[model samples]
Target: ISYVFIVENTGNVTLTNIQVQDVLPGLMLTGGPIAQLLPGEIDSTTFTATYIITQEDLDTGSVTNSASVSSEAPRGDLNDPSDDIVDTSDDPNDSSNEDPNGDGDPDDPTVTLVNSIYDLEVSKEVDELEPVVGDEVTFTIEVANIGNVTATDIVISEQIPSGYVYVNHIATNGNISYSDITGEWTITQLDPDQVEILQVTVEVLGFGDYLNIAYVQSSVGGNDVNIGNDEDSAEVDPICLTIYNEFSPDGDGVNETFVIDCLERFPDNKLEVYNRWGNMVYSTRGYLNDWSGTTNGRAVVKDSDNLPAGTYYYVLDLGDGSDPRVGWLYINRKN
Candidate 1:
């Protein structure tokens, strides 16, 4: 970076042999020169410096540079005191120590340099894309440092969706803690080119669609440049098992078979068909969506020896430890 210093002679008499000096830590001065000044005359000098930022600079977040100017009386000037008498006393308040020329350099002034540039991103995922009630879903949160510099005291926050319940289980490569009162998670720090993954398990309480959001923050202060990617969201959709109430099995190829959407997802399942008299007329193990309203060697075909049209009941056992579903269904024959 480059800096400029201005030295002005506001005195009535002429001033001469003006000099300027720069004192800046963590920086090297390349070039700077000052010229003599006369009454009502002003001179300006520019200086260039270079510095490489370090961890201490990053911690402190600022660097300062100071510059000062001093001058001696011009030659052959009778009113101005000789240059030899200027260093008379060390006391600043003493007249002898003061610059006899009114155009003497002012007090030292400094400029501060501040550092503010870093990037952080967050992303989330779930083990099961489609979940159901009573099922446990694992959520994974990924935090990455995509900035040019390292970030310290990194923290992440998450709120469990209402429909999901926390299983009190978590996994991560970094040190983390959870607060139940605030319902959030916090982590320590993250370095450049580093990624931290946090995994948590939750049980699905209700069905439908749910959204979970997670956010990331760093203690590096204003150095975080991109706040847009600080937070990420993931959604979960549950597929519920449903059974039809009525269907026609009259060989018309439309609604002729008993169908259930989620029954196929479970391999070990069983279905039993019972008439209104409470007698099971048809039973099958591992129901594979192949119930054509046929029972007791009878088919619902026109003028064929088949079961009569009537109201029936069905008992479906998914064998997945869930409650068995018992509901009434109707079989209509149109021949």
Candidate 2:
């Protein structure tokens, strides 16, 4: 990567012996040794430096560089008395060349370093795409740092929406803390080019869409340079479908027929019961909440006389173009 530094002369009098120095880590100073600068002069000249990005840099995302400048003004150009060289005994000009502090340089110069650039991106997902109410939903939040400098004290947070409640045992691959008071999950830091995945489990309390939004930001005392990718959200809508895992057709008038709670809402539905070998044992169209555990083709009345007691498979189709409900059903009949 390449960068540039600017040097300007703001004083009233012309400055001499102007010099610029840049001390940057992981960067080699290729050129930019300015020797002089007149008053009101500005060096907008582009300075060239080379830097090879490392795996760590790519993983962490960025590096910082700081540069400094210095110059000498003629004795008459001195505006403030404090600008004059300090002396205790002899003349200031005579002692000017003398080095009491022994630092070797008599000029004190200061320069403001370049500001940092930032880039952050976030993505969120849920483990259960078709979750039901009261089910535990695990939300995964991914924050990626794509900037050019290391971001410090990074904080990522997620606020549990109104239809959810935060659960215990939140998992993450970064520095994190969970707060019940705020119903939030927080990650403390994320380096450039690095990605952090945070898994938080929450219970779905409502039946409608469960939308969760999360945001990522640098809290290292400065704003993120790119706040565009700082926030993301994911949602899951629970459907109205239920299945019964067991039923008895003993004719005792109690739990005698296989039941589906919401299948009646759709009048064009179909139900198919299969034996252990995937053979269609019972099939019905526009089912009226009836399954006597007997094969539809059987000529006997009792379930034991027609189909033996065992486990079976069922497919419920609501004819609504949605996914069909499939699960195991136990046929418990006593002769």
Query: Which has the greatest TM-score?
Result: 1
Root-mean-square deviation of candidate 1: 12.9
CA lDDT of 308 in candidate 2?
76
Residue-wise lDDT of candidate 2 within 1-335, one digit each (tens)?
A: 66554666656777655445566567776555555667788776645566666645543444544455555547534445444322111122333454445655343222223434567788998888876655788888887777755555666667777767778645555376766566455666666577777777878754333778888633652456667678999987754455667878887898888876546557788888888777778888988777777787433334434577889888988888989888889989887
What does the lDDT read for residue 204 in candidate 1? Answer: 73
Residue 158 of model 1, lDDT score:
75
Q: Which 10 successive residues of model 1 have the least lDDT summed?
A: 84-93
Residue pairs clashing, model 1: none
- TM-scores for all predictions: 0.50, 0.44
Best by lDDT: 1
